[model samples]
Target: MDTSDYNNACFAGISSLFATLLAEESQSEDCLYLNVTTPTYRGSWEKLPVMVWIHGGAWVTGSGGGLYDPKHLVNQGDVVVVTINYRLGVFGFGWHQALNNTEGGTLKGNYAIRDMVQSLEWVRDNITEFGGDRDNVTIFGESAGGWSVCNLLAIPNAAGLFDKAIIQSGGCPAMTEAEAQNVMDGVVTDLQCTGTDAEIRSCLQGASVEDLQLAATGDAPAGVNLNMASVVDGQLLPDHPLEVIESGQHNAAEVILGTNDEEIPAPIFIGVNSSAAYDDILASVFPSPVDRESLRQHYDLWQYGSYSNATAHLQTDLYFRCQSRRLAGALTASQAQDVYLYEFNLPVSTVPTTHGLDLLYLFANPTPLLPLSYDLHRDMLERWTSFARNGRPSGQWWEPTWHPYQTGNHARYRLGNILGMEYPHDDTGCDILDSLPNYRYMGEPNDWFMTRVTPLIGLLDWVLDTIFPSE
Candidate 1:
């Protein structure tokens, strides 16, 4: 939307970044466009590693074109960075009885995820022309984008598309099949459509796109609006992502998984109208008794007279921390690939490391309004670019080297007024997650609690070390 803000940061040898439109016509038919940033127009030299970013918007909103500005990553990382736009909302993931009777009926739901897979397939085919290494590509995203990365790792067709991944603030503990189907049935009832898959498909195909959009976002009988989200369609997605990861049945791409210390505060930037509604939503989603008391105690002990920050604590733990740990553990169990875990503990005053705060650093912007935030951004660029160059981030203070996430010695990057490492042990937040209902894996459950859970707990040790330095 705002291209002018990106003109100066472009580097030499880096040609004009452009968006190309692609389309597929068939059962898996949809728009397949991608925005690419490259160092040169020719495909003569050896292929450069590629970074494909998937935007985050609950799988309902957000366009890859809207979320990224290629100036920094393209020029600095020296790699082709492609941001993609996929189908969203109902057009992306609604399921109906009408489609069930058609060929490949088992692939009814999960259209959005299919679009993502298709986008990757396009990259695998076309990135070579943009001076990109087709054989060495990394997929990264935040929030729903992170969820999409996890989904990509699980999809059988997406195996060789990426060599590495970085997921921030999302995980595989997404909606279950029964839960998703219940939402689907409710949507059908709300639309007053014939229950048959074929009839529903025909009716939807003929309906106005606006009408479909409204129906998808509208409140349904289940009290949860069913929009564009991946489903357990027996074909595209045969099982939950966690199931696949735990069973070691996923792609063998190396992974970097972590979350912000405070992820919930970002929504406040959208508007305050939904504060009460969101509070209820948080309560419903992360109902806690065991962890709540322990968290309260920890807060009181650590930041005495800081009870107001409790809300930020609860929100981050529920939406970011817990889910991140679950995903890391599941991937670690795969043991088929490398998994690196991290936690961004850059505290902004009373707010714990809020959501999207990490974006400032990752993007490496030069905005003057947030200077302290920008310095950290520079450090992030150095580390991340180093990783892009050699699969490992480099820096004097923030180098990412610790025991693997399963060694009970989790390493976190503490980026705030300064950047350094902090190992939090005795936190036991993942154990609290394990105590919850439906938290256990159904297929080949991995004993992640014993292996990877303590590394996160080690964070408490880091926090303590910071408070009482022996020097």
Candidate 2:
């Protein structure tokens, strides 16, 4: 196995810092390594909180090394931060019956998730040597990383690995098992292998890393049915995250979940300029008559009516905001754990409260920022570090009590130039998601439906201001 190293500079000003690598047994033949970071070396073990971070790349493009730099958190919060690299793209997640046969059904799909669980087990056994507390652990991540955190919360085998969790920009309604299989099939075809399960498995095993990556990069045609994601394998993921949450079957851990205000604008704006293109995308994503009717009523499609921008906003709400709300709501309803919900509203000069913008603030790295970003980072760091330390974010002057999101009173922290609290309402968006067919794979444009239904859903939020008037 290959390995890498970082010097004392990795901890710079932090006292007692160490790093190491460990190999863990995996259900899959591949994916058996994990990397660890800690605050010190010790003779006898002392308990320290551990933060196990999972990287995000839509279950595909990211590595544990990409956005993790543990020096700040380790020194400031007095916690151990472990970042593990898992199999990515086709190698990590692709599914085929032949591979299942090879593993004797012990491992079906979701090898990446299994790898993560193994990594946690390794930490539980060995973290004591590195001055970490095996008993206190927090699993956290952003984007697909957050999605992985949600998966862990629901996985039976992953229950005791962590005590708290922070999921940023990913949540329930992520991806289904069938959707993941469709993605795997597309990758297999792109590799030009025979459609048979055995031949496809052989081709994947023989292909180089670069070859697999290239095959995964092409764009989906306009009307193509597509499914790309981490499968809900019964062994690793018993049910959809939402189902698990609703059933109160998730791990008993405190949670912090949030999303950027404008999550999908850039991607949507790039491809959709005309109303026709916007409608095309919407029609494809939300082809259900009931969903379409809900959208019409909720959005007042007559006003602020351009479907293009509306589509972009709708996609953002569906993928980020709505999902975040659902996850938070589920956890709050559990009555067994603490949950916090927030919306990142800090507007960047080039990016408007967009995806990945919160990274700079959360990481607290110096970057060019507008006046608002500067102040927001300071406040955010104070709150976030406070949360990491005591499961409560401390605010200056007045410590804001983060109330759990509930049926009528959804207390969500609105983080922005002016930091405050508010209850979000986008009735149309909620209605569409609630009424849309349950887990239908094809026929009506579900993908486009997400894009079209979101903005109109947001318009319904206008009612929130009137109903619950801000102080």
Candidate 3:
């Protein structure tokens, strides 16, 4: 039996309330690190392919190498896996006009994205010693991590760092300079640090992490959502992700991107108890009377049987499914390289197929929670590793011929109890949702969808327990 070692070094995590709930160890501001997992190897010239993982906590919370045990992926796939930690919340993504002025108004904000690129640079320089093929690297992530991978594709400096990417349930969204400055101004006001540019810079540096965290998240008006996201600073990130991809300026060549059958389920729905509540949310999301009517008609209550389910499905389409398709379309139009799409339709008893559920079968952690079928587990590992090894995600004894996602095609591999290619199941609603001008990516100004969903992030803990009952 070949031996494998999974190194998950604990580092200071992001200082946010969400981080507090998710962290088992103490969290501080000084949190930039990464973990590498490798399998046993002999003294040979051949090295294994590498896959770097970026964890997801909505850009504010979450660290690498804690819950994601890559031992099984390393050993079974015979590859090296690297998990990384980047700054979160204000420390990582907070931006101010004064800070930019202090530094001569260069690319400001998006420290988290820069940290991720730095990790890739580390892998390029040092992964050879760990028996990995740095040139044959594939970067993959879920949620924010997936979002990071998508944003990294748009970053000019991140070019040639990795060869392939797999983005799971992440949208490609970026904020304009004005939006980012507004968010930072609010934080500065909360901290009571209004004065000269020098004084503001000093205040930001001297403030405690706790105070920063509270200032970042506290006392916001009822409708305002405090989120840390990538900024279109015109230097680091040259343009919006969609614009970059369409202009053939993106860094990715081979990609596998998709979402779960139901990325946001009813449990996180929280307050939508009736049809009226659902309509109210729709009005808020699509302020235009015509757009709201189109959506309401598309997600009518009779079809879904209840507003709770309708709202949940509508959100899944708007935030995850449709956005993912938009990214895939952009990739297909820009490059000839393979772009595969998928939908994790596998449903567990008493559980809705939600975000991050596909990970359980991919990593196949041997902790003995929900025992997935051997066929399903094997299929996921082979498909993912196959993509990492070669650009194509085919070539297994028991596997069917998988197709690359193509432009004008509405087909994606359905990863469920019965796996095969299928048509876009929610196209009607996505059609209406995508038509809305404000539904551009995720970080657009005045986007209320994130405001509605951020509170429900805490409920993800319950979703985790429901999936892994042993937790």
lDDT of 2: 0.63
Q: Best by lDDT, which number?
A: 3
Task: Say which prediction, candidate 1 or candidate 3, comes out ahead on lDDT.
Answer: 3
lDDT of each: 0.60, 0.63, 0.76
Candidate 2 ranges beyond 4 A from true positions? 1-35, 39-46, 173-179, 195-200, 218-226, 270-275, 299-305, 347-351, 368-374, 425-428, 437-471
Error of 3 at 158 (Å): 0.7
Query: Could you tell me the lDDT of residue 379 within candidate 1?
Result: 66
lDDT of 1: 0.60
**How does candidate 2 fare on TM-score?**
0.79
Taking the tens digit of each residue's C-alpha lDDT, what string does model 3 give over 1-471?
222432322222233444556774456444566788887553345888999999886776667755787877777788899998888767778878878886556657788889999999999999999889989999999988898999988998889899999999988878888988888888898789979998998898888766777677644322123366788898899888888998898996799999988887876666666767776777767778788788879787788877767888888888888888888888998987889998887645456788888888877653446746667777788888889989777647666767888656667987878777877545787677667766756784236452353335535545644654420
Q: In model 1, how large is the Cα lDDT of residue 7?
A: 22
Error of 1 at 231 (Å): 1.7
Which candidate ranks first by TM-score, i.e. highest?
A: 3
Single out the weakest 10-residue window by summed lDDT for candidate 1: 10-19
Candidate 2, residue 329: lDDT: 73
What shift in Å separates residue 395 of candidate 3 from its native position after superposition?
5.6
RMSD of each candidate relative to the true structure: 11.9, 10.7, 5.1
> Model 3: C-alpha RMSD to truth?
5.1
